[model samples]
Target: MQKLLKLILTSRVYEAAAETPLEEAAGLSRTLDNRVLLKREDLQPIFSFKLRGAYNKIAHLTEEERARGVIAASAGNHAQGVAFSARKLGIRSVIVMPLTTPQIKVGAVEGYGAEVILHGDNYSEAADHCQQMVETTGMTFIHPFDDDLVIAGQGTVADELLRQSAGQMDAVFVPVGGGGLAAGVAGYLKALCPEIRVVGVEPADSDAMARSLAAGRRIRLDSVGIFADGVAVREVGHLTFDLCRRYLDEIIRVDTDELCSAIRSIYQDTRSIVEPAGALGVAGLKKYVRERKVSGRTLVAVNSGANMNFERLRYVAERTLIGEKQEALFAVTIPENPGSLRRFCSDVLGDRNITEFNYRLAGRERAHIFVGISIRNTGERHAFGQLLGEHGFDNIDLTDNELAKTHVRYMVGGRSPEAGHEVLYRFWFPERSGALVRFLGSMGENWNISLFHYRSQGGDYGRVLIGLEIPPKEEDGFREFLDRLGYRFVEESGNPVYRLFL
Candidate 1:
């Protein structure tokens, strides 16, 4: 531990990295009733703290290793880090990335004078291909976050935080992926400032580090959510897991909605849109403060990276209001007589802003309406529901229903009686060309695709909601097929929203 701390203190990352500011987050502090600080690693040369570790590792490579060149596999930020570091060092670098990686990231790596190779569908497959190339060419392979040197370089973040904050921080929140940053920062902080708490933050669906720590060993996940692509690692590094297990005080998991809210919060303060993974520290900090019910203590959140895909902003913006409890969705049944809509609007909705309103006359006597309204908090949703009942309207709160949020809201049409033995499933797959074709082809000739909806979010994975029709006797066979499909899927056939509309 002492040696690791010494290495972090003496790291030569300043040659290619900046001493990013530890600025006060006035907006967050005011809202949370605490002193909130942001470690601006997002302002680094590569727009990510990854440069610190990438440069440190490459700088220490021997002449022989440099002459042979270096290779790495990454879908986003780490690719930029290695490309920038190799350009600065005047050495040949090759970055192998998933075919599904955004063109913006691939172009950025190439702009830094690194050879970019597009291979496979995801990072794991691309990494396998890169390993084969390394064996054949005898080039050095840079592991993203597992190596001691890389971990040491990342630890420098803690050194700067303590110095910049003057060792007065009550807690420091670090984003966890393969566990490099959390391990490095926590190891250094715990050694020097034992009084300061070190907390690791991870996406709820991608909490490999947290789960590993709980199990007392490394545990590999079958799949992970791709919304926070930067930190969507399936397994934590062996060394990093050990370090984090010993140093980190706690690990917190936040969902996609929480991540969206955090991104909005950061944008409000800095006027800079942060990627989902980049805002994870802020999300975890908010969750911690609320859960612990603590106040008046100084807390720091590391703004890890800013390599955001521009197209993802649309999805983030849509979810942010709901995440902050400022939006509510409900299904209301109203009389189909003339002036009924006007009466409901004047008496129930009043002057409240309506974010969405979808309606269809399904019957002669009544109509179903899917409405989204702006509210101050969760309390208002309950109050609004009670108000609707008093106004002689039947209503159901769909605010927390996943099916309603994802599919049924956009699809307000009632179910079709002709569609028999239909099954609904949501599948997550790699977002590469021909991937959908492969999935459809795997279904065989026994079933028909009755409904399908897909929208790209410019991330590594694509989400698809599908409905299939099959005979009742084929139900067991369909289940077996899904299990052998090799994609992450959830059966949504029993979802209430689907039964109500679709």
Candidate 2:
């Protein structure tokens, strides 16, 4: 501990990395009812705190090692950090990245003038290839984390936090991936300011450190989810695991939805969009405060990086409302009659905006509607569900149902039929404004209209499946109505899957 503290005090990171601000997140503080400070490592030179350790590790290399140059295997912020640090120190650098790495990141490392080698399919394979190159090329390998100097450099962030907070903070939340940052920060905080509890946060799907500490021995995960890809490590580093087990107060695991909500919360507070891994600390902190019901105490969450992929923002946005309990999805059943839709809308929907509604008339008695609606806060979904029961409405909350969200919402058309003269037809309509309303207008009270499925696939045309009660007598008029509707239609009533399934 003393040696680590000494190394941190003298780390050479300031030559490249900035002393980022420790600003209070006023929005989070107010909402969580605690003083929440953000360690803005996301504002560092490489837009991540990684360069601190990368530079400090490479800066202290022996003259002989520096002459040999440097090499590393990474596809995220660590790759950029090592490349940037090596360039700053005028050393020849080579970065080995997975072939699956995004072009934006591959370009970022090359922009730093490092030789980028695209190899293998994932980090593990790329890392193995990097080791082979290290043996043949004799380049000094710069680890992203785990080395003592790297740990010491990351420890410097804790040093800054201690100084900025004046030992008044009750706890500090650190993000855990390969456990380097958590290990370093916890070591320093526990040694110098023992009263300030050091907590580590990791994704539930990739919690190597938390599981390791819990078992009193290292445990490697068989596989990990890619949602929080930045911190998706299957195993913790040897040195880092030891340090974390020794110093950390506790480790908290947060789900992907919680991470997304934390990302949104951080944006609301700081106008900064952080990567999923970067939001882990804030998510864990929120969970901690809620579960413990603590308030008014000073808390800190380290915002480790901001290297979010632009394309992933849409997915994050979609999940954020659900995570924050701002949107709730439900499977509801109501009477199947002409005035039922009108009464259901008037009684339940009222003036609230509906996000999505999928209704398929499969039975003569009850109609099932897959619906999404907005709510104000946590626990409101339960209240809303109870309200539905009060109105004699049978409904099942699907807000936290993973299968329902991922696939079931899109599969609302499959069911056994109870209506006679049902003609199943698959329809295609232009995925444009007012197209759906135009199609709906084609149906006239619709002779006990049976099935309807519509989901926009973000394409030129939206696909829909509708089963109408067109008896043999009105087949001619229904065919004329289909022509006026003008959307492409294919009769699927004879299809085997349709015949067997619905």
Candidate 3:
């Protein structure tokens, strides 16, 4: 490893990156009360530091080996790195990726003229399949992080940082997925400047390297939460792990929520959006700076990549406010009497909108309603729970229930669509002062609904499924109004079973 590292130090790859900038980040430095520098690998042509390793590896290949082409497996920046680097070197490259890899990344690899084979559902499975292909095709495998040359090439980032910083960095935070980037940077920095701290950051949901270091041996996770999919590897590579053991000072884990907030922060401060994996180093630095209170230290954080999917932004946006947004679900038992329901809605839930309501006469005197309500904060969750307790209502808080997320929202009752020629498809209007009375008013004076269901899709409107019986002559205008309002409806009025049941 030392000999390979020495060779890499003298290679053309190192020479190529000797002049990369390591300018100070005045904005972040002030925020942390420390002198801060950003290793802007996100500015690489492939938008990742992986290009350093990829280009170095391909450039070192002999003519005969280059003629045989190279193969690699990666679902994120590594794939783009290898593709772009191989194309730059005028060598053929084949990249194997998970079938579920985002279309954006797959297209990027193909755009670089690499033959992309989509296989497996995740990185490990894709990597396994690629290894099999390498053995069969006699093509040289350009590993994403495990090889000595790749690690050495990655180490060049540290060399550039030291040179640009005039050797003043007190600490550096590197993001760890399979540990290649962290190992490479840490290895080179520690080998040259033993006093400089090299810390590694990993997503809490997929901290295989951290867990492995704790266990004092390599351990593979059976499954990893892939919220930060680029770094959602189940295990660190063996070679990379060995390097990490030698050089890394400490491995810190940051939660998914922290990563999301960090993404938002980077966008706010720099107007640049980065994927969750790319934000790990920043997130870790924040936690470390606060916890350690290293106010005077000079810190560097590697901003890794920006391959964020636009669609995933919605989820990140939602989770960013989960603690602040009080979305609650409850199963409440109410009296079977009609007026009892009215009093509970008016007296107990004053101005609190019932997002969902469902009742069933389960061959008993009382009724049970699985209800959902929205609040402004988590504090309201306990407040609402106490309100039910005071009213003597049997209630269960199910805000975080998986089963409720899937099924409870659509449990409203209404009649069959086929029998009611005059079916009035009504949106569950949550704005009424006495929502229960409004619901009963819409149902009929004495008319009972045979079917009703409501559930939120985490959108502006909650979807409600309802079937109501009405006179045949009055249905057409109601149907038109429903269409005009853009509400989705399924008609069951014509079905024989609905007719018979009604």
List residue ranges in candidate 2 displaced over 4 A. Answer: 363-365, 407-502
**65-88: candidate 2 lDDT, tens digit per residue:** 999999999989899999999999
* lDDT digits (tens) for residues 1-502 of candidate 3: 5775695576556433333456576777887899877777777777777888887888889999899899999988888888888887888999998765667778999999999998765566788999999999878899888877788788888878777877788889999988888888888888788899999999876899999998989889866655677787877888889889988999989876667767765676667787888888888887798778889889888888888778677667644533224457777777777687888888778888776666655534666666667787667887998999898887777665433433334543423335433342335333213444645644455343545655333222233545555555665755554555432344544533222222
130 Cα displacement, candidate 2 (Å): 1.2
- Tell me the tens digit of each residue's lDDT in model 1 across 1-502: 9888877977879989999999999999999999999999999988999998898899999999999999999988888999999999999999999998888998999999999999988888999999999999998998889998899989999999988988999999999999999989999999988999999999999999999999999999988888999998999999999999999999999988889999999998898877899999999999999889989999999999998989899889988988888899998889889999999999999999999999876777887889999999789999999999999999889988777877777778876767888989998888878888888788868898888888777777888899999799998998888888888898899986676567
Candidate number with greatest TM-score: 1
- Indicate whether candidate 1 or candidate 2 has the larger TM-score: 1
Candidate 1: list runs displaced more than 4 Å.
334-347, 364-366, 386-394
Q: Which window of ten consecutive residues has the lowest lDDT sum in model 1?
A: 406-415
- Could you give the candidate ranking by TM-score, starting with the highest? 1, 2, 3
lDDT scores in order: 0.90, 0.85, 0.72
lDDT of 3 at 376: 76
RMSD list, candidates in order: 1.9, 11.3, 13.1
lDDT of 1 at 494: 90
Runs off by more than 4 Å, candidate 3: 14-20, 321-502
Candidate ranking (lDDT, best to worst): 1, 2, 3
